[model samples]
Target: MSSTTETFEQYLHNFIESDWLSAIHTLLPEIHEVDRNAVQIWFRFYPLSLFRYLQSAEDLEKAVQGFAMLGRYELKDQIDTSHHFLYGHRYWKTVKAAIEAEAVVFENDDIDLAEEIRQLAAMSAEKLKIDVSLVIAIAAVGMMTLNQTGLENFKNAADGIQKPTGLMAKSPDKIVSERSKDDSQGVFGFLKTVNKKYSIIYDEKRNDGRFAITSDQEIAGASALDRSQNWQEKDSRCWEGVIPVECLSASCGTCWIGVIAGQEKLSEVSRRERKQMKVFGYNQPEGERPFMRLSCQAKASGNATIVIPPWNGVFGKKIYQNVQDVELEPATTSARELRKVVSEAAINKAE
Candidate 1:
């Protein structure tokens, strides 16, 4: 590598700065064509702004919801329009834990910290494959910002390894597979009208394949909510790519989503969606079409891939206040404990 490149990698030691992402970019120097598209999607996770909210969130679920709302109500001139939402939501807990483990390992006298980090990254790549870079990148972000106790908590969360499920991800694999079939005709070939379908792959797990969008319905309208409700009504099998929904009129934030691809083809963010998105703390007055959109409001115009957040809420200005509270906490405090305090405070308010 050139002297400038070596210097840049050295600067990456302080992973807090948004500029540190450039080092991550350098890691993927030679890309295969098949992996090219995935690389672009991964690139979206950098520059920190795209995912600063990830740190602000108290838990994996809130972090997922926050990013989903941001994507659903994407502004035309939004500042952080990146695909970090994809990998961040999926592997955040694991990666956060791994980083905390790194911190604990940092305290060890015999371990080679740099070598250990590389080994962790390599192992992550071997295991998670598609999402390893994202995992390492986000781990870098946490290492830069978290204090020792917070790191311990993060490590604890990772060690626990009990993954949280996002509302949009409650789709049944069998139904998704049945729907994904090339159904040029009915189950018995009696129906002959071939529907114009588009593909939408959820969760970034490519082996899982794409969910067939048989119509131009918004993701919420076309999702597993329909099948879930049907199952409730009758003993029917639930379908896949289902996002949580209530009121479907942009009244609830449950159906919020982040578009990782094909944002241009989705309908423009309507005025009502924009208003709700802001009320939900999903968007700022930066621009329109900021990659975040309500799955209900955003009618897919073509094929796309999206990431569903784990939870949703209606905090409005209070969301900003909550963020402020997190920021004000002493760096040495355990993040897990702070989250518990926040959760308790919220519950007390409800009571």
Candidate 2:
């Protein structure tokens, strides 16, 4: 076996030997609280090999990139060509299925198979191409801290503790100043603190709805336009799929915008959003601007605005489905049903 593979096997051994597995399992009751039976079933066939594979990668960067490639290929193969897999939900389901199927297995008795499984997990992580370590870390911590609670309570706890951003600190001045003076009369309280630090603007003509874009000053003149309108019309040439949005909720990743300039003006990160973003491969360390937010989730306080990201995707689920479809080509009934649902949804939405 390669040195990298060996190292990952060792890491997996250490993880299982350490309290991590038991801790995770204990927390599983809390983590899978929402669907105890389902989660229990899933745990029965957890892909230890995939995890070990991820642990084996040279570094987190390689692991993430490899995971992304694997995920894309897998998705292409598994999902029915005619069906569309909603990104997040489908990918997760595929992972669960892979585990259940023991397709990526680690023989509990064989040390070599264990090592191989570690390598596979690392490969899977690389395909994801995002910081899976962060998610794992978050999950670890969550399990450790909130394992006693039920899934719903655990989720609520996560929501409560998840910081909006790493930059925010507890300060009375910062806290009080951020809120509006007129708390009773204004819908502007959320924007108060945010606007003072960043220039905010409303775009009505484009999406036929209100959305904010980050200003050039806040974005440090990264592009030619200092204002949101100019950025949208003249400066937003680099982006594709830039369009108006109807729903601001997670219902549509359509309003998925990027922080070309001021990412710091947005609110603190939430666990759910963070997980979702990672699954979509949008979170980056260097590009960690406060401005990188979904316009709908990002409420403007003062004058914060932002440019759109270059691409928008709804394939978290599709990627995994692609892989499964390829493996089970002869038994295409499930694939057909998925494709039909996706096609119908797409048609309905387009209409």
Candidate 3:
């Protein structure tokens, strides 16, 4: 039920990372870019480093001490649907049960993780008549759920969701094909406006969740969101954009998104954007085109797919830089203690 055991420590060696996730693209070139990118985005959404570090720590309480604002508990609640954006999401219920059964064998170190994934992927593909590549991605999602919530809680989710929601009903091929469509040839196009129109899928949950962009104005993607009447109902105080944008500049970090597919379609990160991402503690602010990006600063060049994180905050630098200070020595720190520690830290900082 807990990760503070030898089996989990051993399993950590074969753990998946961005490198391995990226290599899957080469291994399964037939896999649609949407499925591939969704897997990667899922990894970014639930960072493995954070999982491994906490599970392996001598004291779980101290490990989670200052990360209160990071909402570690909140993430585990959605572990099951984390990969809902993947093409084969419909097969998650079957996939999860398979993983739960295998998790016990993993604890005994009787089977290798990769071999199990391949076998599960093959069986699920055959049973559901879906692609094994997609199954493999969903299997990784199962493993992620187990890793964070532990086996007991993982098994507790047996009933599973009744079905896939929203945009999931759309064919993946349709979403992929829509990327090539360009609507820049209207009257606006003739008037030297709306140049090189591109489609951007922001909320994969909804089939209608997208907007258009043109090369004419070098405006960022969030700014472009406001231009589209096609988006969902409007909101107040945030420029009526689907994606929340406060500063319009990257300073607020409210409009960040994970570029699930078509990373190359977006312009490279600007100096200001990179600095703000790290300051907000998004993704260590690494690389020119890291998957994590500030939507307000990212300008679309061609069609792209992105997922807006459920929440945003400015705790990256403050929390990560000072994590070591809060680590304590206990494997059983209750959630209340976690909150108290963070609350006290806040009070001290205020003083």
The most accurate candidate by lDDT is 3
Query: Model 3, stretches more than 4 Å misplaced?
Result: 1-31, 51-73, 107-116, 158-167, 187-198, 205-207, 212-240, 284-290, 314-351
Q: Residue-wise lDDT of candidate 1 within 1-351, one digit each (tens)?
A: 344323323333434433343443444443222222333333332223334444455684654443333223221122122223333334555555555444433433343334434455555556566534444543433443342123323333322222324322333333233323342433655443345566665644443444556555777666753332343233111123356555456655556666655666677788777766654545422345556778878876566666655445444434333222211121222323233433333232210
- Evaluated at residue 331, the lDDT of candidate 2 is 20
Q: Per-residue lDDT of 1-351 in model 3, one digit per residue for the tens?
A: 444343653464455554345444444554556576676666666666555555675876754554343322334677666666677677887887776655545454545555555676777677778767667777766766676676667766644563655656667677666544544566756675445776677666666677766763333443544655633344332344667555455545556778766777667888777655654546633566667787767777666777766655444434344322332222223323444543344233211
On lDDT, the stronger of 1 and 3 is 3
Note the Cα lDDT for every prediction shown. 0.44, 0.32, 0.58
Give the better candidate number (1 or 2) by lDDT.
1
Find the candidate with the highest TM-score and give its number: 3
Residue 262's lDDT in candidate 1: 66
Error of 3 at 67 (Å): 5.9
User: Candidate 2, which segments miss by more than 4 Å at Cα?
Assistant: 1-198, 201-243, 279-281, 284-291, 302-305, 317-351
- Candidate 2 steric clashes: 62
In lDDT terms, how accurate is model 1?
0.44
Listed per candidate, the RMSD to the true structure in angstroms reads: 13.2, 18.0, 8.4
Window of ten residues with lowest summed lDDT in model 2: 81-90
